[model samples]
Target chain A: MNEDKKIGILDEKTYSNQIHLIGRVGSALLLMFMLGIPFVIGTVYDCMPKFSWLIQPSIALLAMMGPTSVSEVLGYAPVLGSGNYIAFITGNIMNLKLPAAISAHALAGVQPNTPEGDAVGTMAIAISSIITVIICAIGVLVFIPMQPILTSAAFKTASNYLVHALMGSMILNTFGKGKGKTVIKNKLMLPLVAIAMSVAGVLLIPKFSSYQGYAMLVAIVITIGWAYLLYKKGVVKVVNRDEK
Target chain B: MSYLDIANSGLTYTLVAVALSVMLGLCVVFYVKTRKRALELGISKEVLNKVNRSTILFTIVPSLTIVVGLFAMSAMIGTAWSWFRLSVVGSVSYELMAAQTTVASLDIADTATADGSVFVAVMFVMSIGALVGPTLSAILTKPVTQNLQKAGAQNNGFSPIMNACFMLAIMSVIIPIRVSTGGLVGLMVILTAVLLSMLIDKIASKGVAWLGQFNMPICLLVGMLSSLVWAKLLG
Candidate 1:
């Protein structure tokens, strides 16, 4: 019943094996680093918090982050692939890494969900991650001198708009016809579904921000489910869709 | 030692440096490996060059914005910790929230004078709590990506549609929430960005080769600039 029945892309060699091995191991190591930092600080200062104190904040953190973890993996995996490892590690997925990968693919005139696309995505992320680390280091070195420009009200206000602005421009790139052609025929279906879901979210969820993660998961299922349904119904046709 | 002193300690700085160096080193390895593979796949050198150029240009503003976050958060979390955290799954919002939660649980007034226990606890909460996403990604990304690839490999067009939907799913939730909460400036910023992106795309389609490559950053800048206009108008 799945329309995505495997076909012949015989010429293409799979690139997932090595990338996954590195990705999994690297992520595990990075997690250790994350934990290690605290442990080291605690040891040096001998100031580790009591176990009893952790219970309250852990619960609160779990409530917010649990859904987010699941949602991010589900939504981002399809686009990011092995790049997920570094992208997740680097931790600026929506704003920096994702846009970087997507933009790289777009510039190269490559299609997503393909081997070439995945490689380019990974490459872009690596480049961006490297750049980010370098920039952060530089920022730290100059933190004192740049304090005024960085903390200015105008700068702070503009910073608030960064995500909004970035996402808006990104919509056209992702949803609309930013490049030559896309696979979907009825391109509007998913976006409309997504918008409707958002409107419903706004009307229904009084505290939308706190529940954004849950809403995100719900939206993913609804929008993808809607797209799949339309695909099954033949309402959305695939064009230039060469699986090979 | 004082909170600031502990946060800025040489030990903290050294640990952060080593971790980041490892990460940076890994990026180099991955990039080199992926680059070789890309060439093997017959992607032209010229195109790869374009990707490099485009990526560097596109990344600057976003990365600097993160530093802006770093600047704000460093005051609270300290420079080294802020750098390490932002470079690894750390967001200003998450960092701020984690700090507040840690303080609240410890019954502290602020991060500056909080005990070493409080600082360490804040560190733990920040990392361990946010591990869900990256941890899941590490375990599940390969299989998920393979499945999507397999599905796309099938002659059917469902896979690409699936990919598009995933992005839509994310954008749907994130964009609306921002617009709704952002009020007038939020609304204007989003609208301006959408319009500007569309305009740029139109121009790119007309053969401005360089413009097409840099469209995202351009739209983002213009979009952020539009917020200032809205802010001034309202004032």
Candidate 2:
């Protein structure tokens, strides 16, 4: 391990380069697989969809999901760091990947957007993805037998609240104490204002519900502006330590 | 084979299995490679192991929830497509909405009566609609990370503040949705989770270090399980 560390120190840049290269290649291949699956199924089943059939729903979904997709990438990439590649491929960004990354960083005693944080985030995402795949695979295998139990009203109700529970825990853990509290203290007004604005937007103007998709984006923009004001006012202290 | 036969055929099952295998294989490969790089960065083995273990623990509930989602989708599409699509990209809700849109567009009474061509179209649209995130991430992550790093370099607090704002923004949107939709039971779960998390953090701060590792998962389980009680009382 000592010898490995010596080599690691000597070749840190090379290692980073390798990771970047591999990630790009892996992502490209995964993209092909994603696209390829439908095509392969179409061919083997001898059921080609007409262009119009493809275009109509595609346009509808793209219209609905396009902006949010853009926002998620822009918003989450920074927090995810190197884990962006894996997280994006595996899906479940907001609920699974982001929470896992944040939780892992907290557990590892690292702050986000740092080398240690990035490393920990990447490892956490990888493990989380693996576990998700395993569990989903098992679920698929037993889905026939388990359908009644899994789809039960009691289980369904609990499952519906799962995200609430997960996000509640995540918010508390991520912003509960220490550095998180410090950051929150300095910028508490931002979230409060954003939350108020979101509630007002979603509730007061029912017609504006069409634009409800942009709620997160709007809140983020508002919070970023408020944070900037705090930064300029020197209310929030930016701490930059040397990379360990 | 007819449309229904094709949909439920051995061939379709084989293809789904192969696709799943490839997906899982890619994840494993990525995990091994990334873990190696992390190790190369000199992260301690102990830290990596702990993170890995805790992450798996944290993921169980959410992953099972996704399974429930998969079951819901299986009602629309068949089991193979539901499993494959949810495993690959898009949440259950997103895929279900896309599938519904296609079904409506085709004017099919139900997914069961839909022909193979209709199923293919549904799958195609679902896959394409969900591609934007991963595709954009693959294209934009490097530049985004670079810009964030540059900003952080100029302002020591930029990255941390930005991260906090991002997280808060997400929570701000989600919490309201949960509150309004989840009702009394949901509210109870959220409050339970928040309070439990605070207690755990307090305990961890008092020197029970191991508890810190399990804090989020513990709170999550308590919150989810207690929802049953809340449900019963509210009902």
The numbered model that scores best in DockQ is: 1
Q: State TM-scores per candidate.
A: 0.91, 0.88
Best by lDDT, which number? 1
State the fnat of candidate 1 relative to the true structure.
Answer: 0.79
- Ten contiguous residues minimizing lDDT sum, candidate 2 chain B: B149-158
What's the DockQ for every one of the candidates? Answer: 0.69, 0.60
Steric clash pairs (candidate 1)? A47-B117
Which regions of candidate 2 fall more than 4 Å away from where they truly are?
A1-17, A178-190, A205-213, A238-244, B40-42, B154-159
After TM-score superposition, the amount by which residue B228's alpha carbon in candidate 2 deviates from its true location, in angstroms, is 1.6
Per-residue CA lDDT of model 1 for A1-244, tens digit only, reads 2333222233343456878888888888889999998898888678777877777897899777888778677777777767888988888887888887777777766656678788888898899888889988998989888779877888778878888887777777677743545456777777677788787888788977777766776787888789888989988766763421
iRMSD in angstroms, per model: 2.1, 2.4
DockQ of 2: 0.60
Candidate 2, residues A45-68: lDDT per residue as tens digits? 788889888788888888888887
